[model samples]
Target: MERTGTMKTSKKMMHCFLWVLALSLIPSAFNGCGGGGGGGTSDAPKQSNNSEITVSSNQINFGSLVANQTADNSFTIQNTGTRNLVIGQISTSGAPFEIVAGSDHCSNRTLLPNQSGTIIVRFTPTANAVYTGSFVIPSNDPDESSLTVNLSGVGQGLNVTINRVDSSVPGNIRMIVSVTDANGDAVANLPNTAFTVFEEGEHKPTIVVSNADVHPVSAVLALDNSGSFWASRLEVQNSAKTFLDQLRNSDEVAVIKFAQVIQLAADFTQLTSAAEINNLKAAIDAPYTDSINATLLFDAVYNSVDRLILRNPNNRLAIIVVTDGQDYDASTLLPGSTHTLDEVIAHAQQAGVFIFTIGLGADMHTAVARRMANETGGEYLYPPTPAGLNAIYTKISQILINQYEITFNTTKLVGTLNNLHVIVDDGTMQGDDAISVTY
Candidate 1:
């Protein structure tokens, strides 16, 4: 009975030990499904998806357009990342450059990953010149927040400025002519065949052409300071000042105020790199006290022409006269008005001076103004009101500020090296180009 009791006690001890072992394994069994087997979450934070943007091209060129004419070009934008891209706005900085929203599919729009949108741009220039600008696309791309595109174009037009004729050696005369596109850019590589020299009803027996773009200009800005002008004196002053600011270095200017009297407001002041443009503008403001009622338009023209002849005998010369009425000095015997319209025209032609006429009001002698400008190979402009004067001045300054002189010695530059200035304006655009040689 003792032996049987010993075996039973041993079996009971074994059963209790097994129970404890099984309990310890229960925790490990739970851990086995979520630990080394790799079936559980990590303690680190999750990563979010990101977006990226790309542009097909960073540059867009319009090539060329006539002044006031427009052209368009397009570029592509794409979302190349894992997430969507949101473009907020499209903007530009500069004149003549703008977005063509009607054809633009990208601005203020959302794009899915791997999707692309197109943006169209337009260029329209108001003047003949080289235009530069840039447009920017603002977006929600993490890598690329904004995309910038550069824009460029040129404007074309035609102009011919002439008759800075120098004849110090009798008939051995050399005349300067500036041939430019409507945008006022110089035309190059033109032969003497481009010009015709007519003296009174006669063509010259000889002609020659050369590049004289560097020849200095002696100009006269004859402004109206009469009673009619009193109504717009401040506007006139500001406009005249703006005109002086446009002149190139080495250009000499003389200001004259015309009314019943022809008074010299400023002497020939040479504008240079060192001189302030305001100094010239101040001269225009200082001379205006108020003007007399009489308009001595012709006498003023005569005086300006005569002064140019006396001062710059062998240089490029011009007389820019702004008047509101006809030559009252021709009709009346005024102290300050002595020269007649016929006398002024004759003297201007003899001196090889160009007379640019600007007619102000309805009382302007249109025939006289036209004659002065046309006869002297200068442009004639009629500004509807005084407010348009600054723009008119700018147009005139563009011509005079850039001129070329082609010399002729009694008839022939035959077989000699000559400059060829090419200018073209088909109304939509204007352009000029040239190459030079000895004349």
Candidate 2:
């Protein structure tokens, strides 16, 4: 009987231990289908399950972009799972650079498992400001609910300016060129730096460029309308036209015509059109019928120089006088309105106005004309006949081509008359370095 009772108890104990083992195994089986494995969770992101998409680069970077220029870049999105991955939203940080629309920005786009599509990116910069931003892509997958793209860029500024200099000693005009880089800093070691001067539509030669600081220039053209000059007016007209043709687009030109009353044919206008200059030449050649008895030569010179005093307070001034050189009667200038011939010479010297005199004949007050020319640091030329006038015109044209303007900083001037000397360093001129210092 006792042995039978022992057997029953043993069986009951075995059953109890078996029940505990089964409970532990049940938990292990549930864990295998629950959250322990890579793809166990129902909402877990998985490339193999087609629930997640992969981007080649989470951030796009554009190093540097220049002002008024553009730059571009792109990336790709791939699906590595069996399910479709849909990107529901894309957001970007709104500072610095901007987000330009790309193919991925299109609505309702989906990537199939094991297939790939593109997410193009673009950055546009405005002004010279530095910028940085990011783009975020949100999706249904829990692992990659948000994909962030980083961006950065910079803009460089540009610079521009106009520089003028005085090549004129007493009262002349000259310009300087000093172009700057994008940073407003002057470019170093620039080649072929030059400034052009113009009046109306006429082109003057390039002004000699030395330093970009202050350039020096002194120039003037005086015209003769004396009765004797009338005979060669056509030649004079041609000479004037040729001279105007050689003018640079930036230089200043003053036209003077003298007989009794000195007339300013033109003043300080840019030469932009040939027609305008031709019109001026026609007007200059128009007939003047008064008797040859009144050539107020000294008065004209004085007037031209005096006018320059107002035009430029500190630049060296020059006068080109076209005349017959006959001091027939003179003295038409009102008292206090002008100076005597000697006084005009002295004033020109004091003011540093160089006078270049063109005489119509050696028979018509040649001595006086030559003297005036010499006193004012100028030359006197006699044309004699109409054909001679044309030759004279050619010679004068050559001289004008050789002319340049010097501009000095007014801050360097004492406002008193100062001596000016020009030295050209062109080695090709052989031994002829002695430049005629006009003014």
Candidate 3:
């Protein structure tokens, strides 16, 4: 009985030893087969190193812009990882917002580790309203493959002004119109079918001439450099240069600065090159005396038209005058004052010149300016502040560049003071003008 019990105890001890050995080998088996327990083994799972994309901004606000004006902004994309970032696709939402071509650095390109790229965005609103859109970019970023940039803008209203109407030939009348939306913003692409005409207080079938058919413009800039305008002299000169910059290569411009007497700064010259425009700017920047502190408004107007009428007789002629005060010389205060208001008007009529007048301050003689513009079939403007000078000049330049010539048979109304009226219908908007035509 004792020998059998001893044999059973031996057998149980052997079984316990085998179980302990198997438990000890389990950790070694797991470590040899690429498990988490291994720290310095070649078969361990590798850590991931992925490329990431980060943007400079996610939103862009364009503030406020005039209709048809263009504005731009830029954003940056950085690759913040250990691998190269591949850009796949780039696109915009729709109109008024676009990715400017040649300005994107990430299109179908690879950005190495820690490298950055740029994307330029442009906004051009066609009408008055608030607009919203987005720009999308797809890349090989591990976390974020698709990115978006939000865009917003506001467009303001546009104001149109008819400056003048004149007839060089017997049966045709030329109308000068100015269109602007905001400071330094001019409206464009106005169609020809937007005009109508009435002759002798009767509706006349009018023919509209496209801007391409009109001849090049001949314009004279009449500036008032009196003591009252001293505060805005530099700005005035700069604004006049802006006006010259807006003219076409085929257009001719002359400069006339007046205080008590009219001084010709530049003769009629084509603005074909930068040198010519700079020469005119330099002439405008020349020195002048304030000793004769009188406003020779009428004399200046008459002389400016006289200078333009002879140069481009067949081309469209115009005189733009800027003044801060009334015609002090109209009272005959200065010695040897040559021209009167009536004589100036008659000369303008005979030469078929349109006159545009701009009044600066409350002391401006609005009545006289209005009379001159009205009698010559031109328009008068009174800007609220000096900062608005550039915009007004830009509008005038656009007007000269985009005028319509309307023709009607006036042979039956010869020697008669006929009333002329015009209407311009542009889809949702309409404009009208009336004047007296004497043959």
Candidate 4:
């Protein structure tokens, strides 16, 4: 009986060993047949069922950009996956670099398998410097959940401003041109011959002189302290003060405040001393106790031009009008009205007085201001906000100081109203501005 039992136990052991060997071989068989062997390993890489993201470029170079100017570029994003790919938030890291609006196709969007889209980026440099930033893109990519595109650019410093100055000489037209670097500093090294002037009928300048040699200026500040500007009175005062501070000591300024009536706050006075400038600021900041019933816009401008023409006909004459409303006094029902638009424009042209108008708010008549400026060879500026007034005033002051006075004897030119065109070229840069003269 003991021998029989030992033989049976040995047979049982052999059966157990065979069963274990068979289980191992079964997995190998399934793997070789490409079956679903959950516990088996393969030498080949496993294919993922999730989405994958790819980009056309990893970096963007904008090269060089001018301060306050904008440049743009674009890139493509693709989905190489069997399943749908979803893109999430997209953002830029720097102040100047920005993702252009309506240009990002992947933001909060879904892309089907093998689909692609484009994204546009823009750069606007406010100052001169090397700018660096990145665009961060988040997506449901298995390998890369987030992607970054490096951005780089350099800002250049160069800007040119031109303004016309009134001249009493028959056929003589003057221009105040300034070249500023990125830092807003004047560049004085440019030669006088760099300027090329053109008349309406002719292609060349009669005569051009770079006023790099300083000259005196006669300017008038025609301010509207009317009801419309009451709320922004402080801003107007500050802007006027800032304008005065920027003028040269040799420049003469006059102040005219117009509301229901025009008041000569300060007569034509030379801003040669700090006390004179302070007195002018005080006059500007003075209370507007007068009634704000009407705005004597055209009349005020006419009177200011008359004041400038009477005081200094030989120097560069300019009238800067700051107003927030149109000429309501022209209705004939109002009092203290003296001149019409046509009269003002005629007087300005005859006297060679340039009119620079600054319309403060949307309520101001842009067309009238633009006409006045265009007729007298001046500029019209409408600042979007009160904060921009100071900058505009500073720019005008710079133009006044760094002007190019062009004088040519027009004995042959015969006309009461002559068309004048001026061109300045420094080989690389050029500027063209026009004016009308009554000789």
Candidate 5:
């Protein structure tokens, strides 16, 4: 009996041990089955080494150097990666700036993990300038496909910015310009002796710098009061008043309101007078009350330019035409303007008038208006809504008010394309501008 009992106990102990061992081996078998053998998607990330790029600085100032006098500067690029980084071409823009060949170790080279390279730059300029430009760095960095580094350098002082070029008169070419020094400050109080003018590369002997910043301006304001502006009337009038208040005392401004018929709301007058400004506001605020629903945009622009020409041709003339849509007067049921778009542009060009156009909404005839502005040396602005017209008017007024007009006598034949180059020397520092105009 004792032997049988001991045999039963041994059998039970062996069975229990086998069952526990099998349970432990079951997990190992499941683990052994997962060795990247699936054809489906895996949620794990790639284990490949990724190349990274880090720059020491994004800006390089080469300081001031002489004209054609070359200076050297450099920036460092480091690779914070686990793999090799291959860099591509490095390109730069703006004049007198270039990359020094055989000296750039960062471009067209392989940078190993934790390695650094250098980008060498050369500033060999032709004229004195306060130059600002940038260069692009392309690499095999996963996070950064490319990077732009800003670069600035100064060469002596002369860098001319041409504000605009105009044909103010039949025999004269007018130029508006401003000069900046090496420090980028406007150099003021320059004289006629400070400027040298050239037409078609031939030096002109008669260069008179007249119409200083305080010079008077003659401008006409053309506001759209058509069917398109029915919803925007109050906003339009408010913006027009804002423009009227900003003009200088010497500006001869006219207010022209046009719907189906163009009306000279207020004739040419100076905004410097309180009564003149009030008159312009009142004219702008007057009700149309007519059932005519058409826009004579082209005619308004044409008549405004004509009014400016009739006022005084010597002063700077500009026409600010604000509209929301195309001209619909020709097809209207009411009497309207008869001038064409091409004729208006031609007249403005011949009169040397700048037509600054403001397109109010998305449906505005901006393409045609832009052409009028571009051909007449004016600007076209599209304010998303009418409320933003104040800022645009402020910009236009400032530009027209504080301009220095330099008139040069040119013997070039009419309708000939003439390229004019001007260099204005502010005694010590100088700047230059290049312009092409058919006169």
Candidate 6:
């Protein structure tokens, strides 16, 4: 029994010795493979001489950003070496562009041995400005100490819009404006109150007031083409040709003819050459036979005021109305109808559209001509004979070249005489001052 007990003790001791040796080998293997000490908790990291870490994309690509647009990007890092890594101080270095959210914007983050993590970068631009920056990524691993990432983008343009409205009662001038930029966006901080209103060919009017934002020129030409004037059509054409010949090429002129119903000889067009002017006149003179309908004479006048004069706020505006005689259909949109002629006339006047009237002989409505001219500080003419057309045209040409533009900040008033005060010559109305108000 004593011998058996001794043998058992020896075997147990041998087993214990083998277990200790095995445990020692396990730690050695772990230390060699992991490089860092194999202890579960080791504050001091083990250093490896033969290991390295590298970042695949050192640059973050953010492509094609527009104004008010945002963008994002990311890159990966790899540990090809036998050591652990702790990334420290990842930062962006550009203006206007800021880091919104992501790991890329972090400072001092840990990365395990032979392990990799992705860093995200984000950008948001405030204005129309281009930007570029880099992320300075610092790491504990000497081989991959610092990783540089590039970021870039562009700024966009401002958007603007312009809208105009006309409100004239019994022949007064009224207008309002709204503006935006090229991107179809409203421009907030614009100095629109300093905007100035000027007529084409005219010096800025002497009406010393506020608002100086400059605008384009607006104009409408209402032509008369009727059977009653068929014999004198050529003469009327000559006068029209002469009048148009003197107009600036920038003028947007529309020609309307009325007999049976109102028709457009031509929509708005710019007069470039004498040939174009002659062509316009010839178009007016072309032979046509349509029984004159009860004329919506005032309706045509009002429509011109609404469509042409009150559409674009960036220009000087005016209307020239031509007619020959009585309305066959007098039961149209006059004072007692859907839209009163007086209202239309008042709107045109208030919108700052100068009104000119051309009457053919005694057969024309003298009252309408007189009312339109008187309301807008314009002139009314009666060409009795066909040959008188050229003379009338000459006068019109002179008037076009001699008129001046005067914008006054009249106390916003109501009713017909709101803007009807006489534009007195303040010694400021000279040859240079006498500019074409109706382009």
lDDT of 5 by residue, 302-351 (tens): 88877777765557778888876487754645435587778988898777
Candidate 2 root-mean-square deviation in Å? 30.3
lDDT for each candidate structure: 0.71, 0.55, 0.74, 0.75, 0.75, 0.54
lDDT of candidate 1 at residue 202, scale 0 to 100: 49
Off by over 4 Å in 4: 1-189, 203-206, 329-338, 409-418, 436-438
Clashes of each: 21, 58, 2, 1, 1, 34
RMSD of each: 25.4, 30.3, 22.5, 19.9, 18.3, 27.7
Encode model 1's per-residue lDDT on 1-439: one tens digit a residue.
Answer: 9999999999999999999999888767977866743334455554448777889888888865557656667778998877889998788886799877587798889999899999778898878789999999999987668878888988755555554455455436566666555443446665556555554334554656565546677889888877666788787788877877787777788988877777788888888844556666777887555446677777778888878977756567888887764655333445345766778878887777888788787667666677788677676777788888888888778676556565545443433444434343444444544333223
Encode model 4's per-residue lDDT on 1-439: one tens digit a residue: 9999999999999999999999989877877778654473556577679888889888989866557666678889988987888999889896789988898888898989899989889988876578999988899997888999999986655544444444445555555555555444455556767666555577554465756336688899988887778788788778988999998888889888988878888887898999999888888877766677778888899888878768645577889998763777434646445677889988887776778788797687766887787677666667888888998898678766765666665543445666666554556544445555545
Clashing pairs in 3: 163-379, 194-424
**Each model's TM-score, in the order given?**
0.51, 0.42, 0.57, 0.57, 0.54, 0.43
Writing each residue's lDDT as its tens digit, candidate 3 over 280-378 gives 998889867544477777788888877877875667778888886366743466533467777887788777787878878657766677778757756
TM-score of 1: 0.51
Supply candidate 4's per-residue lDDT for 216. 81
Q: Report the candidate with higher lDDT, 1 versus 4.
A: 4
Off by over 4 Å in 5: 1-173, 176-197, 203-211, 329-337, 409-417, 421-439
Q: What TM-score does candidate 5 get on C-alpha atoms?
A: 0.54
Model 2 Cα lDDT, one tens digit per residue, 393-421 = 55544443433333433322334333322
Worst 10 residues of 1 by lDDT: 430-439
